[model samples]
Target: MAEKEKQEDYRVEIGGDDSKRSYTPAPAPSVSNSPTMAILSYCGASILMTLTNKYVLSGYDFNLNFMLLAIQNIICVVAIQGAKSMGSISYRDFKMDEARKWFPISLLLISMIYTGSKAIQYLSVPVYTIFKNLTIILIAYGEVLWFGGSVSRLTLFSFGLMVLSSVVAAWADINAAISSYGHDASETATALSTLNAGYIWMLVNCLSSAAYVLGMRKRIKLTNFKDFDTMFYNNLLSIPVILLCSLFLEDWSSANIDRNFPSAQRNNLIIAIIFSGLSSVFISYTSAWCVRVASSTTYSMVGALNKLPIALSGLIFFDAPVTFPSVSAIAIGFVSGLVYAMAKVKQQKVATTSLPVSSASSASMRDGLKN
Candidate 1:
């Protein structure tokens, strides 16, 4: 405990106080605050979100991603407030200053969701999931830039594998795009167009996601905000931004109200929407909870490990083609992600080990000077 305090003091001195932030590491996981439950909730919510979006966008032709996200944000705000009212969780009262500090991160969050939904609308879930690995690469680079850390040789090697795997997956997508070559010229043209647009949106989503995660890290550290506080601020503040974007960007005239959202189909749509919103809530809460209980590296590893299952589920549920190239690309992506996760875990362990030694050395020097 003394050593831990010394290390904490050393870290604060080196890292500088984050605006006189009242820093508090979240409590360790117990039966009441279970890591396993958090992980399960995160995984389930993520999978449901992916599957639900695919069904709505691809199956029902409901292409208003911005509008959908706005609705989801609204739902999040209402549900969180309801929970607070019931005393399920506690958060500090919202202040204008804190909202202003949180707005930039909210913008990044909006971009990430908007672009990701657009990509999912165009790309099959499997292809989209594989390509989404690119976000890991971007986040790794962001950490290096923001935190002033050096990447290890092994970590660099893992990054190389990830890059190679992403390239191969992209190649497979291109090949799939043109595979309808002889069947229907018009269909081939459509597939090619969607593939092109999907790749662009996917890349945009990766960049935005990386930025959001990094910004969220800064906000949490600097403001000393807890998970529920972060969720409340992000969703509540994003509602208006999302609404404005929807008004300009979405084609309200093109929305087939009767066909896409008929009264008879309202049940399915309602279920999908409600579940989608709730799942998003689950994701946000669980992700933050998991990171608090476990380490950030563990949170990252859970995400990396889930990719393969998600990819496989997509294949099983969707009508996508299964060829040697596609299979190989998926395998490569899964393997590369695993390697990246391992490299990251090792890197974090090294950092942890070095912290105690550095703190001890500093303590020794202080003692010697006093003597």
Candidate 2:
């Protein structure tokens, strides 16, 4: 009996030991995966926006364009707040007071309006996308000059390549636009004038976009506001600015809703508006989600990737040209932008790891030394 009791006790101890050994802590959840999803959502939104521009705004005057964009931004504000509520996040935690430093936000609104209007006027969707990416190069140079940061020779070479590629793409777009108007004797003069105007507007758009990017980076870092909160504040601030711009700059007299479209096209326009609203919400939410998961540089690269699909879709939908040189330019620009992004990410990771060890680690090391 004594032997049996000892054996049972030993078995219980072994079983308990086995149970403890089998136990494993759960893995840390990955935040990086969310960025990939966010990127897809953003790309999807761009495609929807392209479709809206092509079909809905076909014969409408410029006033409608401004109004539609304002409406989209308004929808974005509401959607972002909805997303925050659903996610159980509080804007109060992000410190709204910091947004009072408004220069960057105002610049961003200006950039958006300038870029949107100019791209629609002068360049095809694909061409605008290729050149708009210059903002990234601008930001890099801005940092080197404004912040006294060191830039590698490779980065400069990459920028040069992108510039050369943009020239090639622009040449192709100009040729395509000219050829399309060749059959229309009456419209040729108008097309030429529009092209010149587009070029000028796009230049301003690029400069404003660059300034906005650099300023936002500096301001966000200084304020240390959460990404969601920054987005919310930016969208909110942009609403009033855009509204004012539209009210003054747009020609309301030309906005004849019924006359602009045929009976058959009216339904299509409504459908486009619905889709635009949905896409705006998706874009605002996913972009904020992406910033939370990945660094801003990564988000920017993903944004560049969105241009490819937009370009391709524009070609198919709007009968935009797809010349060899233009395609090559886009390919080179995208590759270089991606390379720069990867380099930035690597540098960021290195900087993060190189930070000093926590106080706990230092204390533990001292305790060991004393022991």
Candidate 3:
């Protein structure tokens, strides 16, 4: 899977435009547009996006996460509209039927982004990033339950490691907090409570994200929307929903621009949101380009490999505490992601080989002879 949250954020390059058609992997691009270059662009943009959002939510104390997301979505919608006007992209007009069909899945997406933001607000970047690994497992199991796919032994082993690492990481985080802040009973209690809340929200984030991914798999088929179309509809439809959520769920008095604008960091918050929006645009383009230039297999590997750099950057950039178990847990999670990536490659290869192309052709020829 791609490292990014939104599935429709990428433009998948395919041979034709049959909405319900199956996909065949395209050949890799040439040296000038190499997989390495694509992967680097994608990884860089994604890392920047993640760090920027974390800074906005945590460092800038712009805790109105839903509103921030709404702003981002608005930016995306404008960009898409402009691109359409400029002939840079093509998309279908919005339809009420499709909008109605997409409403429930959009709710799942909103939940995913909201809980993910809350998780980042409460947890360190490294912890939050590592916990995101659980999404892979959640989506995998969700496929097994909802799509009739069976889990293999390797997948089982990898997911088991991820689960174990999550437990160890949580324990390490709690202990490290106690060691650092144990002198003040009240502070220690607050730290413990925050950690607990962060983990709970992280779990919710994983489940909701998993649900969104799985639901989109079916929803996309029904809608027959390609990448740009999907992005347009998903973001456009989400604006109103996100606004309602921010209004009801958020404390607008504190998050209001009139109140926070007087603060010294107002300029900083503006800069952060601008950068966040630009980086999001960068990510959408680079990630899709990566998938187009590289194979999906290489894209998956890049996503797996990028986790280490993101984990390290979190610890270096932020003041997240370092501990043996926490470090070890990240390492284990990294390896598990690699395992999952390898498993995916093997499965794709198997699926390709298992296609009965020759038999289908032969049957067609026999029918032609009869005709």
Candidate 4:
């Protein structure tokens, strides 16, 4: 315990003091209180998961979004259970009461993932990356309304830049699509129609993502769930919801299976699916941990910073065009992220400096009560 305190003391100097924050989303368990570690882990997992999911959903004939989600959830549960049996991880066993409380977030998770997949299907990764910045805006205001947290003016300015980046990205995506296709005027409007669908889905994804983050933060307080427990409940509850969607909503006919899982691509799809499922366990856990140790808005900002590598990966693997407008937008978005981080650092310093005055007032109140 002395050693742990010394480690935490050293981290306080390096990572800023979490206890000094005006409002904490929830009390973080000691094991997962290192905000820096949580943020870095989450960013890595998030980037990998996004690229892998994109690869899986990239198949032109793939239309089994619900089925794919169900498989991922199943794999998460299996992986966690296997790890538990091996004594590699520690988390509480299944409890009906906890599951009941966590079920709503599971529904939100379904919407977030389903809409995300639908959007990425119709959009390029670069366009998708820029549009996701909109979620940070939503989550920032959400933290204000729900957690009594305040957004600094600098942060708000950064938000404006993020919005500009998205608009520029959308404009560039459209122009590039039309010009690069080299289609004659006689061609139909297929590309435009697809892009329009993607935009609609992106809006829904942003909304669902904000709600999921806020909802999970609130639920964490009520459930007293650690990151591992939250992840366990999320994947476990999602399995049934996704399975239900796959059963009634999705076509399960033999013909559809062959179309979605073509013989030539079957083995590759399986491999990707397995890898995605395994990685999801870490992604979900680290996400919950980041939200626990830091605010949802900060978690969102880390996501913003994470897009640089993501955009590069998208270009390398997915053939997303590297155009001037796209590069400019990525640069603007990256700058916005840096500005927001600076804003947060300033905000924390102010909070920490005021703590002594609050402590003094509390001491006086205690003395008065004793009298």
Backbone clashes under 3 angstroms, per model = 0, 1, 0, 0
Better of 1 and 2 by lDDT: 1
lDDT-based ranking: 4, 3, 1, 2
Local distance difference test values of all predictions, in order: 0.74, 0.62, 0.74, 0.77
Best by lDDT: 4
lDDT tens digits by residue: candidate 3, 69-166: 99888888888789889998788988899889988877877888789888988888778878887887777667678766656787688788778778
lDDT of 2 by residue, 1-371 (tens): 99666555554222465464333334467644666676776677778766666555544543366667677667767776776779855563434466568546655665656465556645677777777667656666666687655456555666776687688887776676678888987677787777677777777777776666556656666776555566666667677777787788765563465555447677766667667766766665566666567655566556656677887777777756778877886787777666655655555555568754322211111111110
Q: How far is candidate 2 from the true structure (C-alpha RMSD, Å)?
A: 9.5
Q: 1-371, model 1: which lDDT tens digit per residue?
A: 99778657644332446655344455565654777877776677778878887877777777678878988888888988998999988888899999998899888888888998999888878788888877766766676687655666776776676677667777777787687574888888887888889999998998887777767776667787777887888888899999998899777773456556767777898688777888787777667666666656667667777778777778888877677777887888788777867876776677678763322211111111110
Candidate 3 RMSD to the correct structure: 12.2
Query: Top TM-score: which candidate number?
Result: 3
Winner on TM-score (2 vs 4)? 4
| Residue 187 error, candidate 2, Å | 4.0
Which parts of model 1 have CA positions greater than 4 angstroms off?
A: 1-33, 262-264, 356-371
lDDT of 3: 0.74
TM-score of each: 0.83, 0.77, 0.83, 0.81
Could you tell which candidate, 1 or 2, scores higher by TM-score? 1
The local distance difference test score of model 4 is 0.77
